[model samples]
Target: MPQDGPQPVERELPTDEARDLLGLVRELVQREIRPVAAEEEASCTFPRETFRLLSHSGLLGLPYAEEHGGGGQPYEVYLQVLEELAAARLTVGLGTSVHSLSCHGLAHFGSKEQRTERLPDMLGGGLLGAYCLSEPASGSDAASLRTRAVRDGEDWVLTGTKAWITHGGVADFYTVLARTGEDGPRGITAFLVPADAEGLSAAPPERKMGLNGSPTAQVHFDQVRVPDARRLGEEGQGLTVALSSLDAGRLGIAACAVGLAQAALGEALVYTAQREQFGRPLADFQGLRFTLADMGTQIEAGRALYLAAARRRDAAKPFSRQAAMAKLFCTDAAMRVTTDAVQLLGGYGYTADFPVERYLREAKVLQIVEGTNQIQRMVIARHLAGPESRS
Candidate 1:
């Protein structure tokens, strides 16, 4: 007979502490996340309490500095944790990634006073965060974002609409990028805007095909005033900050994609083995076995690719190209693997009873988020063949 559930992924952790961390994450997923994931996602319920629990457990800040109330884990270990969480629920996994991405500018470029004052609470004080970059008119061409941040002495007045923001309305804070000078990348600047700012509001969450449990909406900033203290890097440095954050964020998305693919593959294994036809289980059929092998291979390869890129990041090496490659390959692999998983399950896969169909729907968004796969290819090509001539 087939094995019970998906087998635990055997990770090559760097230390005992990392192993223990993964163990705790797995336990938490089984007890809190996986059991209710299907139901809550179907109902479009946000797991606020679950995220609070993760904050209390220090899972939300696994890849940041120790002195800042973070877990001080390396990217390799932290990414593995993301993979485990994502396997249980994409909303939780992707939400955690977005939260980390929201923290990037403040943590990396903020003044010492800023880090000392705000980093701790944001990282571990039960607060959640959202990233604001893509606007309604500037999804791929982020440099063209029209959000305006005009200086009014000590405070800046921000006005614009940020589109497709995860945790849009519910987040405690937002990391916002807006134009501060002339048009294009050089004019943009980053800010840490409180969610309750006077003029900041979110539209109704978009009706998405999947990940309904995590809210994605358009956030409007209408003359929202922010103190200069909230500014992240220097004025006109927003694109630099945003690009750096995206390189790391892409790796997080890659890990999530692998986790999602792994989940679908596990479901396929158990269902095919138990469901029988022609006096035999589906596992016995050579055709199905080959499909299983391909799925397993893709998941493993994707995992390795993301991990390799993560290790490069941890080593303080140039990993932008590798990160883009990981994000591109892993997400595409997830789409293929999840689609094959649905096919392997036959009619049952088409129904809501099994989770494969949901996985298939979720996998598609990965290809589009954190810079679409097309963008990833462009980044890689730029690295290899230099930037395209703007003729």
Candidate 2:
């Protein structure tokens, strides 16, 4: 398998159109994103220009149909673009992933009028979006989210706080999953809430260990009101929409993890060639060479896992299990590869003087977000042994 800098030739690869889109994204990443990546990540600053650039390039709406002002690209192509972005900067990749997740609930389930009214702005403009599913009490158990949305005549009064909301106050809109009924997952409903809605407030950004440029916070919905038309789907379909969206979203995270791993591997390869010990290059050592080999192997495995899952999605096959497996494997690979990249760089890797440290820090969150690795394992195990296996 090819490692670092060049796209590997996989068996039965993407179509010409997909390849073209992938190439376009890579070019944008190299020219526009890579230059500012270090600085923006260091200062915990979101690159608004990057968001605008992507939106203008028709990349922001890649997975949506062409009729909705999107590029009419498949998830396979869209995910490769995400990989390219992650290789350049995790913050951008993650921000894009969150944006796509927010879009998923609406794109799949919104009424025609809702789609016609909102999708144009969402797909065409440089508007950021947030997906609110997690709460202080409900992370893995998303169905248990306490945020309440009570029907009030023609509107819904939303109250309660959502935690770990990506884009938080910065987003132009939010996809909120809240309880409209009394049961667990079955009781939930989803809504497309505007950021400017009254009583919606964001706490100061969380101080995370990595992906600092991607702001996250607790979003409090204090009796915020929205028209019933803003509902994403029927009352109980909220969990359905959220879960299906997460299935696809996991693949996006898998791609991002691969990109991050590839970046770290590239950094390590370059550093080993340049850094010498005892008048010999570090790369010349068998141990270091083996380390690089392992990193390359793990990254290749991750790439294959995600691509297979993406292909399954494109084929409209059942891919939830595959998506969860890919997310778990790739994120774990990222954590290992990035740590090894830092090890290869010696003391310099631990400092901001090199990007490997940042890569390591950025890689850690991949294991935690989208869904925790533990949750991913549960998803995979359930698929392997069937639902009765839980008994």
Candidate 3:
């Protein structure tokens, strides 16, 4: 049989408050998230209520400024909270990360008036958000996005479709990137668009392999008119804003990946210990024990790597290279650890009765999202070797 629940992960927190915050997160996970996770995911039910609860409890905006209705936690502390949430259910964890990503441009680059007007409501109010940069033809090549924003009097008319958006239809707001001048990245600008904009719409959510409880859809902006006041950052700095947000968002994904792998390892350890084979527990065997050790090692290494990158971010240092490395290594580690877990569970692991199978499917997507593992490698390589020559 599977264990009662995932075991607690030991953490080195910076303060007593962070430790207490982790305890509360774990409590919420056990009491609410983990119990209903499998059932809700099976039914593709979005946990809007759980998100509302997180907002009320001040979890939705942990790494932002306290004056903006955020928790004022450092990235190091904030990411561990994400890890705990992900261990219970990835939908909630990744949803929170995406919401934070959506808020990045407004919080960091918007005018003081804009932050004063919008940040508090977005951070802690009962509102959800989506980031809109990926498009049908522009996933990795985000700079090539064709979403156009034409100036119209004091308004901008946006017309494009954003593909693979996390909270596509359900978000209260979207942070959109659109081309306003030249054909390349320099001409793009960011906008904070309300979901109720006149010409905004969303297609049905995609049928995904896992994380069914988190809706992913394509959002359409059919000449939607946004006031100039809603524009974020300067008229031609969208890529800068988007890339900055992604560096932090990658750390979020890395933490979530480590949490997922840790959960899988916990399940494997419990299942193997209880399962018998030839008058001995499966865990007593050397090969399976070695596998379990490797899984645990990978999870720990991934956790440490992401924490290091997060610390760099907290100190206001250049961490783009570290962020890419963490995203690459942690997500790849998650895939390996989860797969090993499924093997350890034998035939039972393949069945829906065991969460290892769901974990395996979920791990696959992490390697693809937030810039694919390939893109991560490319980013890391650029940091090492400089940008590739165009000639």
Model 1 spans > 4 angstroms off: 1-4
For every model in order, what is the number of clashing pairs? 0, 0, 0
1-391 per-residue lDDT for model 1 (tens digits): 2223477999999999999999999999999999899999999999999999999899999999999999999999999999999999999999999999999999999999999999999889999999999999999999999999999999999999999999999999999999999998899999999999999999999999999999999999999999999999999999999999999999999999999999999999999888999999999999999999999999999999999999999999999999999999999999999999999999988988899899999999999999999999999999999999999
**Model 3, residue 172: what's the lDDT?**
97
Q: Which residue pairs in candidate 2 have backbone atoms (N, alpha carbon, C) closer than 3 angstroms, thus clashing?
A: none
TM-score for all models, in order of appearance: 0.99, 0.96, 0.99
Error of 2 at 190 (Å): 0.4
Candidate 3 local Cα displacement, residue 143, angstroms: 0.7
Q: What is the lDDT of residue 23 in candidate 1?
A: 95
What are the Cα lDDT values of the candidates? 0.95, 0.88, 0.95
What's the TM for model 3? 0.99
Model 3, position 40, has a per-residue lDDT of: 97
Better of 2 and 3 by lDDT: 3
Worst 10 residues of 2 by lDDT: 1-10
Runs off by more than 4 Å, candidate 3: none
